[model samples]
Every structure is written in C-alpha cells, then in structure tokens.
Target: MPKTAIVPPGTGKPLAPYVPGILADGILYVSGTLPLDAEAQVVHHGDAAAQTRHVLETIKGVVETAGGTLDDITFNHIFLKDWADYAAINGVYAEYFPGEKPARYCIQCGLVKPEALVEIASVAHLGTATGA
Candidate 1:
C-alpha cells in the first residue's frame, strides 16, 4: 500500500499551500517552492541567489516532513525565468547539495507567478532498499 506525507504550513513565514508534500511508495515528491514568506509574499527581492537559497530551504522542510533527508534526494527539476541567472542559482544549489548531487534538469521558461524567478521540485528515495 502507498502512503502520503503532509508538510504542515510553516509558522511566521507564510501560509504554504495546505498540501506541501506527498509521498507514494518510496518516492517523495515535493512541490515547487518559491521565495515566498509566511504571508505568501515574495522575499529576498531582486536577488536570484538569495531567492534560490530560500526555495531550497523550504524544500528541506518538506523533505524532512516526509521522513527523508537531503541525501535521499534522487532527482531535482528546476524552472527558471531567466537563463542568465544559472550561475547565481548554481552557487546556491551547491551550498545545499555539497557532496553527492542528485540528477537535475534546469529549464528556462515562464513561471506561473510573475515575481518568482525560480521554482524547484524534487523526487527523493525514502525507502531502505539498497544494493548489497
């Protein structure tokens, strides 16, 4: 049977979507997180690097709620409104996944929200199956 995990909305930050995360089988799928604060307002204005860090931090919370760690991340999908900010984004991304990096794909496109420059979603392995 499959189970679902719920990431409670953060306090003093912003009211994250009621459904922040969900897990199925051994895969934990996190929603795209932006640099929005507790009030659902964007923070770290005009700084792509800072925004990226904020988004990643939010992802960390979601991952933990799903009973997984950053090391368990297997894949990451990044959406960016400006390709020119790739270097800045990478700087922040490296800080989060310092050693073993997950498989990632970054694309330049229009984000659903105007103020959001980048949004990241991830899939992680939370089960114990491993090669002997």
Candidate 2:
C-alpha cells in the first residue's frame, strides 16, 4: 500500500498541494520545495544563489523527515525561471550533493508564484528498510 507522510506543523490551510513526502515501492518522492521561510514567505529574494541554498536546505529537511538522506537521492527535477541563472544555481547545488550528483532535468517555466527563481523536486531510493 502507498504511504503518505506529512511534515509536522501543517499550516491548516491549503497553500500548496501534495504532502511533503510520499513513499511507495521503496521510492520516496519528495515534493518541490521552494525557498520559503518558516512563515511561508519567500526568503532570499532577488538572490538566486541564496535562494538555491535555502531551497536545498529545505529539501534536506524533507528528506530527513521522510527517513532518507541527500545521498539517497536518485533523481532530481529542477525548475528555473531564467536559464541564465543555471551557473549560479549549480554553484550552490554542488555544496549539497557534493559527489555523485543525481540525474537531473532543468526546465524553464513560469513559476506559479513570482519571486521564486528555482524549484526542486527529488526522488530517492530509501532502501529496503521500512519506515525510514
């Protein structure tokens, strides 16, 4: 059966769709995490690098909550509003993944919300262990 896990402190409002993480068939699918702060407000405005860092950190949190680590990531989908910021984004991304980066596809899209330049979604292999 598919299992869904919601990150703590649910906002009690439907701001964004989908739970933070879902596990099925040994794969954990993490939802796209933006650079939003604790208040759900966008952080690191106007700075692509900082925004990247913020979002990555958030991704790490979700991964851990799902009982996995960044190293377990097998694939990633990156969305960027401006392709020119790829270099800057990569520079910050390297710090998180370090070695053996996951396969990724980056696409330019019109973000649902403004002020967000990048969005990242990941799929991870949580191994055979149950309840990571």
Candidate 3:
C-alpha cells in the first residue's frame, strides 16, 4: 500500500503546492482540478461547460495512468464560482459520465482562479478488477 504522487504530462508548474493526484490503498485521490492547459494556463475563461470538460479530461488522463477509467470514479466534489452555470456544467458532465453516475456534491463557492467557473476533485477505487 505504498503512496504515489502523479503529475500528468503538461501539468506545468502547479499553481499551488499540491500533487495533482495520489494513489494509495487501492484508491486514487485526484486533487481539485482546474481547466488549465498543458502549460498550466487557465483555459475557457468564463465558460463553465468548457471548463468542466477540460477538468474531466485531465481527471480521465490521471485515472488511466493509474490503471483505471471514468467508471472507476466513485465520488467527485465540485466547486463552482456561480450556481447559474449548474445546468451548463451538468450538460457536459453527463457526456463524460453516461453510466451509473458517480456520487457527487457540487457547491457554489469561490474558486482559486477568478476566470475559472468550476473546479473538481475526484476519488476512484482501483481494486483488483481494475488492476491496482
């Protein structure tokens, strides 16, 4: 049950002092992810849908690197700068997770980046089925 830190390609320099994701005890804990591009520049400023998509894509990359998939995601904690963008965010979210949706809690809160409309943190279990 050794712990491992993951920093996806093009993650660039982290805005804050935190690992992008950690694998420990058969679970992957993805830190709060933003819509930063390969160079770490925030993308899709002011657009919740696009930002959400980018966040999920980053998460997908991390999960795959850990030998898991979107289906392995069991929970997600979403933070939004505005609640008005809820519907738009959900629209993109459904496309990424069309299966038995992961347990999630989304709240309207101030994000680290002003232009960012959304940020998300997720947890995925990497059991024997998924080859931990």
- Candidate 2 lands at a TM-score of 0.89
- Poorly placed runs, candidate 2 (over 4 Å): 8-14
lDDT of 1 by residue, 41-124 (tens): 878877889999999988888887777788999999999989888999999999999998999999999876678889999988
lDDT for residue 59 in candidate 1, whole number 0-100: 89
How far does residue 8 in candidate 3 sit from its true spot (Å)? 2.1
Candidate 2, pairs of clashing residues: none
What's the TM-score of each model vs. the native? 0.86, 0.89, 0.93
lDDT of 3 by residue, 57-127 (tens): 99998888778899999999999999899999999999999989999999999888788899999999987
Candidates 2 and 3 compared by lDDT, better number = 3
lDDT of each: 0.81, 0.80, 0.87
- Shift of residue 27 alpha carbon in model 1, Å: 1.2
Worst 10-residue lDDT window for candidate 3 reads 123-132
* Model 3 misplaced stretches (Cα beyond 4 Å): 128-132
lDDT of 2 at 87: 95
Write down the lDDT that model 3 would get: 0.87
Model 2, residue 90: C-alpha shift (Å): 0.4
